[model samples]
Target: MRIHLDTGRSGEKLAAEWLSQRGYTILACNWKYGRKEIDIIASLDNILHFIEVKTRRGHGFGMPEEQVTRKKLKNIKTAAEAYLETFPQWRRVQFDIVSIIYAPGGHNIQLLEDIS
Candidate 1:
């Protein structure tokens, strides 16, 4: 469990940095509403993004993005709604996923935008 948590945290950090390099301004990390959590909240080009970060050591089971099921998306949506209630200034919103596959030598990252 600790290893899983560590990997997830590392992945989120990488994702945040990657987004920053691409001109995304990060607003929050590990933002939660109830039991649901949005891994990262960022804005780019006037669009607010609620992002999910999925990290894995390898693809033994499958790609990291494949783990994001419909139920998970629903939960993210619910959390995003709660977030918007607090910060209603964001009229344009998008859902995204940052998938990371970490290895000893390197890591592969992919960003899936507008997932919702």
Candidate 2:
């Protein structure tokens, strides 16, 4: 469990850095609303993004993004609504997933946007 958590944290860090390099301004990390959590919240080109970060060592289970089920997306949406209630400046909102495959030598990352 600890290893799994560590890998998730590492992946989220990488995802944040990757998004920053691509002109996203990170607003929050691990932001929670009620019982739900948003792994990362960022803005780019005037659009607010709620991102879910999923990481895995390999494809033993499946691709990282494949783990984001409809229920997970619904949770993210619920959290995002709470976020907007606090800060309603964003007119355009998007849901995304940052999928990471953490290997020994290299890591594969992919961004799936507008998931919701």
Candidate 3:
């Protein structure tokens, strides 16, 4: 449990920096609506990106990207809708997944964009 928590935090930080490097402006991290959470919210090219970051130490269970199931997407979409109600100035909203896998050597990160 501790390992998972640590990896989640680390992955989020890394993802935020990666987004900045890509010229994305991060608006929020860990944005929540009710019981659900959107890992990151960023914008670039007039598109508001709702990102979900999944981090794992290995593929023993599965790849991180595989963790974003239909239920998760539904929750994220709901959360995004709720967010827009408060901040209604968004355009071209998109969904993305940042999958991080950390290993003995280093780490691997993949950004799968516009999954929604």
lDDT of 1: 0.95
Task: State every prediction's TM-score relative to the real structure.
Answer: 0.96, 0.97, 0.95
Name the candidate that leads on TM-score. 2
Per-residue lDDT over 1-116 for candidate 1, one digit per residue giving the tens place of the 0 to 100 score:
99989999999999999999999999999998989999999999999999999999998879999999999999999999999999999999999999999888999999998987
Clashing pairs in 1: none
Please give the lDDT score at residue 2 for candidate 1.
98
TM-score, model 1 to reference: 0.96
RMSD of every prediction: 0.9, 0.7, 0.9
Q: Estimate, for each residue in 16-106, the C-alpha lDDT of model 3 and write its tens digit.
A: 9998999999999999999999999999999999999999998898999999999999999999999999999986899999999999999
* lDDT, candidates in the order shown: 0.95, 0.94, 0.94
For model 3, the run of ten residues with the poorest summed lDDT: 83-92
lDDT (tens digit, per residue) of candidate 2 on 1-116: 99998999999999999999999999999999988999999999999999999999988988999899999999999999999999988899999999999788999989998887
CA shift at 70, candidate 1, in angstroms?
Answer: 1.1
